[model samples]
Every structure is written in C-alpha cells, then in structure tokens.
Target: MKLNKTLSLAVVAGAMMVYSCGGSGSKTETTTSTPAPAPAKEMTPEEKHKDNPDFVNGLALVKQSDCPSCHMVDRKIVGPSYGDVSEKYEITDENVERLASHVINGNVGVWGEIPMPAHPALSKEDAELMVKYVLLLKK
Candidate 1:
C-alpha cells in the first residue's frame, strides 16, 4: 500500500510538472514592435540636437513636452523618429515653415493613419525650433 501511494504521488507530481512547464515544441512569440524603416544612426549629443538655440530649446522642450510620449529623437515609437522625418523632408526654410504648420495643425497622411495630434500648447516659434532639432538628425 505504501509503495502504491508513493508511486501515485510521484506520478501526480510528474504530471503537474509537465503540465506547469511549457508543452513540448512550443513556438517562440514574435515581438510586436515594428522596427524603424530607415537605417538611421543615433547621433551624439553635440550632433543630434545641433548647436541651434532652437535645437537646444527643442531638446529641452521635448523632454518636458508631450513629444517623448510617442516619439524618440532617433528611433520610432508610435510615430516616425526625427531621423526618419529628416530623411524624408528637405530641411529648407520653406520646409521648416511647412513642417511647423504640420506640427501645429497635426497631419495624418505623412507618417500613417495613426495621426499626429495637434499641439495647441506649442507656439509657432516653438514648433519651428522643434522642427529644427528634428531636421538636424538628417542622415
């Protein structure tokens, strides 16, 4: 009787261990995160923001502002990274104006249907500065 009970308990324990552990031949889960499309490199502190006062302002504002909630300076999050934007658009003065408008007005088609929300809190000048900092990341 003692041997039978020990054998039963061992079988139960073995079964529990097998059940608790992953089933055999389990497939690994794929990461849901999408990688950045561009082969953009991370820039140095001096190079990333550039020396523009506006760039500096953007670097500071980005941290305090809602920018970091979805965007990274060099990598993509919910939105494209500044590097990818720089690679896409010309860094001309006209573009600066246009992008600032884009930033303030909030466009959807450029990056995707995800839609960048408008920044009513950001002044035009601040938008321009942020755009400058982003443009500086152009590869």
Candidate 2:
C-alpha cells in the first residue's frame, strides 16, 4: 500500500512538472496582441506636388546630379536652400529660362561669394525641369 501511494504521488508530480513546463508532445499555438499604429501625417504642399510629372522628373534629375551636395529643400548648405531660391524667384518663363541658364553656365555673387558650379552636361530642358522642381518647394 505504501509503495503504491508513493508511486502514485511520483506519477502525479511528474505529470504536473511536464504539464507546467509545456513539455507535452502536443503542440500549442499562442497569439500576442499589439496596438495598431497611428495614422500617417498629412503631406505638405511640396510633398503633395511630388506626384506631379514635372516635379517627379525634376526631382529625379536633381537626385541624379550633385545638387544635394550644395543645396537642400528647406535649409542652406553650401548654397541657399531651394525654398529660399523659390521664394526669391517667381515662377515665370523669364525666371525659368534665366535660372536654367545659370544652372548650366554657373552663377556667382548672386547668392553670395560662394559660386554655383556649372552643370554643362545638363541640357536646357533638363536644367529647366530641375529649376521648376526647386521653385515648387516654396512654402
């Protein structure tokens, strides 16, 4: 009787240990819940204009070139910011042509003592596109 009781208790304890440790041969699935992410912020005017054909093409041109090395959208780097340029110059045929020429032939003493390097490799059309994109960054 004593031996039987001891064996029963050991069996129960062993079963409990296995059950508590999840060591049973059967597999169990567990799911965890997480909170949903917040909604995306609204895009600014310039950001919204990104989908425009001219903006897209011009942005691509700027990215392909070394424009970022000296200029940025909102803040000045080696040169004035694109936003500043946009604010300084209005969108007009004359302004676009003049700026495109400046981009291709380079300009000095316009922004400051620092000179804008010429991108002679860029065609007039491509340069105008880039200028238009820069101008579109106006706040």
Report lDDT (CA) for all predictions.
Answer: 0.82, 0.92
For model 2 the local lDDT of residue 70 reads: 97
Worst 10 residues of 2 by lDDT: 42-51
Clashes of 1: 0
lDDT by residue for model 1 (1-139), tens: 9999999999999988876775464756577988779987777755754657877887777677888888886789999988888888887999999998988988898888899989877899889888877887676
- Candidate 1 residue pairs in clash (backbone atoms < 3 Å): none
Model 1 alpha-carbon miss at residue 44, Å = 2.4
Candidate 1: residue 93 Cα off by (Å)? 1.2
Instruction: Go through the candidates in order and give the C-alpha RMSD of each one to the true structure.
Output: 16.2, 9.2
- Per-model TM values vs. the true structure: 0.63, 0.67
Residue clash pairs of candidate 2: none
Clash totals in order: 0, 0
